[model samples]
Target: MWKIGNIYFIAAVAVIGGALFGFDISSMSAIISTQPYLCQFNQRGHDENGLCLGPTDDVQGGITAAMPGGSWLGALVSGIVSDAFGRKTSIQLGAIIWIIGSVVVCASVNIPMLAIGRVINGFSVGICSAQVPVYISEISPPSKRGRLIGFQQWAITWGILIMFFICYGSSFIPGTAAFRLPWGLQAVPAVLLFLGLVFLPESPRWLAKKDRWEQAVEVLTLIHGKGDPNSPWVIRELSEIREVVEFERANADVSYFELFTPGMINRTQVGVFTQIWSQLTGMNVMMYYITYVFTMAGLSEPGTNAVLLPSGIQFVINVVMTVPALLWMDRWGRRPTLLVGAFLMCFWLCINAGLFAVYGRAPYPGEFTSTAESMAVEGPPAKAIIAATYLFVASFAPTWGPVSWTYPPELFPLRLRGKAVALCTSANWAFNFALAYFVPAAFANITWRVYLIFATFCAAMFLHVFFMFPETANKPLEEIEEMFDDTKPGAIKYIGTPAWKTKNTRNLALRQERNETLSSEEKMGVSGEHKESAA
Candidate 1:
């Protein structure tokens, strides 16, 4: 049977998994303020103006958070499933789960049912989010690996932009269909992903680990050699993979406990913290609840296009800004991109917070606790806050957004790659669940102070990236392991080490020299065999 062997096509298909994540993000953000959504899910009844109100800030937060809660559990188990079944099958299972979860969410009749459905959907997202990057990284060539893995983030932004518009359009429908329509449509990308997986190749590294050497070489040849099994590039890559796999099989037992040994712990910390700080950047708060941020910025009319339209622009910016990362992350490298992004994100958040503090006030006079109260910051300062929010998204979309997904999966050894990435991705979902649940109440009581907290987080992450994270661009997966094999006990060991330098390309030169020697030997052997046959 014919299957896709082209790297770019495979990446496009795999990243639909990331798009499923995008769909869930804006699925609620776009429709949460519509009357159909509030009337059906908000148990607190209507206000004096006949508009519906939520039962409380906590209830609403829970409804928003239910998916990520399920996602955290899903991420935890994804490693086990991917390791046992292979990367392609694991993603296919996630797509199936997402379709079922979408049905439950679309048909939900109450808050509990709604939350239950979101959790199920979250579980599917968890599996996809954890494994998709691993699958892509394994299949991609080192020189283009960052860009290909970056396609996952670009897909996510496209998913957000597309789903937000879908929900925005549905909001005009007069009843439960407003929310139900978009929820039902969430299954479309999952359906496409599952079907697409039918024609995609499994991870070559997974094949190598399973001792399917012939199949692994075939896949590597197809992906990197354009069908030439004897191509020098293919031979070198296969040789490198076999060497690492054999060494790992002889030296180590694969287990979750392996992630924390003294030698492995630094790589593990870098992997896990890369994800944790991505969430700590508080970008999802923008994706998941842009409506609330706009409301606080004085675009307070909940169900109107005015509020929804501004958010659509933010989503567009997210999609557009991500393109540069996909094109240039290898050139820019991971460490500097992350450092610059963290500082810029901190700057934008501080600007937003300051604007709100100076010019904003609470809409209700007494103690604030629910969506019933709105922030009364208006006029030019409100516009500035909105502008700053846009700038924040711009900084994040290009830098941390794609790098977060690309960095972790490439950090660990082949034996530990799946589980290590799963743990790292779970950290992301864990924080995602917390912020999704907490932000509504934060908006009600603390208001602009939330931005200040995230700004501080960004500042801390800037230092973290500078001091701890090493450069990992333009090097083969096997070569990346060398950066973390230090005898020193702490990350400070990387401060002036060879691994810290962004321009390190010594490994590439060594690999090229090895490939040349092997090619010359092959030519000589073929000539000698012809002479023997003639004799």
Candidate 2:
């Protein structure tokens, strides 16, 4: 494997956990709405005749929310698990957990059984969500780091898109198999992930940090330079790993409290709140309850197929937009992406709120209410609302979705990286849980007014990124520490500069670009010579 190619293969396989996480997202939402699921568990209860037994809003919220609650605890503990067992093993653990969860959900006989299953599966997702990006970030070369980690977010969206279509197909299934078959199929990816890990190598940097220098050098040779131990690039990268490890070993006793001190608070705030704003972008609101939102937007057809239009639009647009976003990520500064996304998200939400207010009257079905109560708008206004939602998803998928996946692992120093990322990931799930639980009530009570609250948060987040979050594009992990150092009160002048323009990041990016060009030229020259020799 020459030039990090092996790293890409491993990352792609490892992020299967992310795909399962994404599969669970749309699948559960799709299931809870079906007549079989509702009739069986909706708490409205079946008479001897088994009629009028649709699930209550509370049951809907519970089934939808169970995973996030488990995810929060899973994320909170993932760092410790990774640190104790290494990144590869943590991934394996998650896969095993995923298999168990899928079994429970698919076999469920009641709401409690299904909810318990969701929570278990959520635990698997929580661990993978935090650990996968960390693993990818640790293994990736700085020049290609953003793109590699972006794969995890891409895999997640891919899973969601595929699952939505699967849900579409499953809608034709009669009885409980519509949901059960999809839940069972979700386990396939987890099994693949577990089997794949048996052959892959651990993170070279983690091996170095644990004082296994020989193994680290061996992996570095293979991934960085096709197994040439004497290769200059291999030697240089290995040396950097050793140096980083030594530096971290000297300051290795990191505590959670230390993250809040004056010298570290800015980094802490940036890492923690990036996750917060991502959820606040209202992306999950749509993701978790797109069926409800679509119904309110006046989309309907017979069976679960009513979801086909909105779900298809979401899947295609997200999968397509995300590819280019990853390409632009390292070249364009991270701060600009956040700021732009926040503004556009705010704009779209405002438009949605305005359209709903003008086109539809009150008795608006709140967030918690059924679509029957909320589907008041018709014709053009209804279509406009649907368009607004797609726009919102468009703004979000490219910006917050992938950026949130990459930024946290880049924010902390080596000594505290694991804990910080784990904590930050937990924050993401915590907010996810809050919205998953409360959005129903929010929609039911305030209706269109709900968008106003999220829109305001988007405005605040944009300003925060402009003044508070320093740009981190193209900087090496060590250079990131220098950027945070300048965040102290007396050094605030450096905060707003584009990371690409900062002295360290600029020099590094230029060097990386030059090397890449030379590499391309050399390969082309060799190709030309080979053609001459063959002829």
Candidate 3:
């Protein structure tokens, strides 16, 4: 509730930038197969029903892939902007860029214009996508971090659900305005994001990193203790942060290469691969091309309403399950949630592929006809395939969808958090780029077998998590640094027993020092600063 903490309001509003991010993602899906979309670019041999009579797979891929491409660049460079101008200001900068891109997309008259606009808008998302999680994570307390950080993904899904409905409604209008109107609506979120950040405080950790200690302390008190500068909890947080930031400053530099150093490599691997697994879950096949998937589902008329069913199912399930994810993450722990999700996703993908392998038919090329009405194997087979797709969505929505975005930021130390996030996010968009570029051609060429490949990847991801990932459920952020400093093999799984988890010799010494300082402060009758208490 807004009454509980200002960080909730700040984080909730700041991440509307993610709404524009989600808007661009699903917007093109609505228009791509529409008559106006295909005809506007002058596909010389394209039929009126939206299928190209000539080779246009690559063109379609370019239109869809441009945003991820732009996102890649924006993510790589976002850390520079975020570090130079604080997190709030960086988000504002990204919103301005998003609005510019939305204008270009709304006014697009051809395929090139459309692609260019998507890329530009995508660049803005890249910046937001990279920074939003980091910003949310920084302002949030260790106790409520999961719920707060997860809000960015929730905002993204809300944007997606809204845009999908908008597309369904706009399909009634005859002509390009149907798509143009929706494209321009993105400005609503983008502008709202810009205006909102003007009031939000900068990320306190970033202020601490910049050595603006007074501002950092002030912001931390405001968010964590309702503006009580002398709150004992705030003092403990400041001391804990000082330890981590001081260590990071002495040893770390903000660079892509720094992510791979021996001390930080584990964090880097977890961060990067978490993102890769998020992409390989095969979620995008449905996300960006549900219309195509439905058209092939043997429906007589794959109208907007018909297609809307699957997209709507996905959005609704995504919104519904996100709440449980926030609740379960802190209690059930990260590794359990992710591994179960991976296993279930693999199960669903196999079912999806098997149904298609036996009962489904590849879509007819060169004719966007309602041929499914006359096809031999209709009815249950198509419905079964749709069911399998929804099952996959159910498995993913509660788990990988939010975990991927939330977990990676927690992996990095605060000093290099911005760049580290950007690095992993680029890895995410990189795989997304590959999938978007190849999925169309794969559908045209291989059909149902594509699910088999993703299923295999899902299995591999499950194994990777079992071996590589650790359980960091309720531990303080500073304690996470000590966990990674441990070099023993399979060291992460040693949750309650290991030196890192047990508050080993080094931590024991720190505790003793904290007690001595607290004793001295108590004697002086001044409690403005307090030492961190043992967990």
Candidate 4:
């Protein structure tokens, strides 16, 4: 709640960490398409007449999908690393790997070398995505926690937009030298992230759990300097950490398979499905084939349209929308905000699908092909559909896009958070890879069905939230532990309606109307009747 210089520094560093993941998402797509890089290299492996020679179609797909592949591995490993080495070390390692990957990509002479570089970078991004939010959540005060964690997503969107613009601007600079500049420029943030970590204190909650009281105190001092280190605020946080640790110690040592045990099952389902929902919404699909999308709408070219203006705009919109997530998160509560946003996403994607389905049929003459290339089409109607889709991207950025990342860290209990996040977040990368690898192929074959598929996913998630996602706004972390219990069947259920229930429960009606009835009953001074109703 209080504005402090230290909070900004912590947020800024966390954002830089976020940027590493974001930049990688869009940066390589530009590199893959740039003629000076991709085309000339193809010619290099050609015969005397300049024809295909090195790295066949399958090899190229592997190279392009390198980061996603590595991310899957990195995410799988992040749980052990974050839990064993701590969040700081995990992030520091990610930065170092990212820098190496950037160098490899920048200096790569062949597809294999570039793919190797991307794999290294992808590993780093995976670790960051797994650990950074956990760190942010530990350090943040609950009041501002959602918004601060939301910053990671906001930063990611900005990073993607910035990378796109850099690629766009570089493309016009007239040579391979220009394209190389953008690849090289990516190294800067990674370098900064590596350097900035020197000043950052490790998570106080993490230290307390480890029984490093002196270290935890120092970290707390860093967060709440000039204010008494032993102030009630500081003590309250320490107590919460102790309670979390105690709770962990009390639970039986459950295996991963036990994640399906009733109470725990809901969160696992939410974590896994929410991530799947994110990809199925077609965000990654749009990202992977923005150039093709633009071209399909008759916007691609030997001219300015090659720049991926629609994605670039969406990136900027995402960045702008992220600015308020931190503030509104505490104000609106996570479930209401997330549900509202998810519902809006359903509406927007469905609308975009309808528009595209209506006008995007009947491919351009001679442009339609069996191969995975944009079917160049054009007109006012086409432009309208493209415009609508870009707006859809903007909507996603602020809502499901960022909320997906923030929710998992906050919702999961401390002991299992690392493993759960690692598994769920990796699933995200897996879906990302699937989308990136198959979207072009899907579009060429399935046409507007791709958008329809996304719309269906978003709609399903909207209904799921209306029925299940709990309200976690201003409540203290300890109070929400009940939601994570394995014994409570509807622990994940929010305060809503009886019809929203997954199974029949007699209390559902009273629970839904509990608040409205309480005030009126109190106004009439019917305390006995109110007491009887609660019973």
For lDDT, candidate 1 versus 3, the one ahead is: 1
* Candidate 2 structure quality by residue, lDDT tens digits, 340-415: 8999999999998888788865443232236323435678988888888888988988788888888889888766
lDDT on C-alpha atoms for all candidate structures? 0.87, 0.78, 0.75, 0.68
| Number of the top TM-score candidate | 1
Model 1 lDDT tens row, 1-535 = 5778988999999999999999989888887777788778777776666667654678878888998999999998999999999999999999999999999999999989989999999999999999999999999877788999999999999999999999888878888999899999989989999999999888989999999999898887777766667777778888988888988898889999999998898889989999999999999988888877787677756445567888889999999999999988888889988999999999999998898888988675322224634566778998998899999999999999999999999899899999999999999999999998888878777877888999999999998888778888877888777557553233234434743464545367457746755775687689789999999
Worst 10 residues of 1 by lDDT: 487-496
| Clashing residue pairs found in predicted model 2 | 42-55, 366-443, 366-444, 367-443, 367-444, 368-440, 368-444
For each candidate in turn, the TM-score is 0.93, 0.89, 0.88, 0.84
Which should have the higher TM-score, number 2 or number 4?
A: 2
Error of 3 at 37 (Å): 1.6
Model 3 clashing residue pairs (backbone): none
Model 4 spans > 4 angstroms off: 1-5, 41-62, 254-263, 303-305, 309-311, 361-370, 486-535
Candidate 4, lDDT over the whole model: 0.68
Model 4: pairs clashing at backbone N, Cα or C within 3 Å:
147-326, 263-486
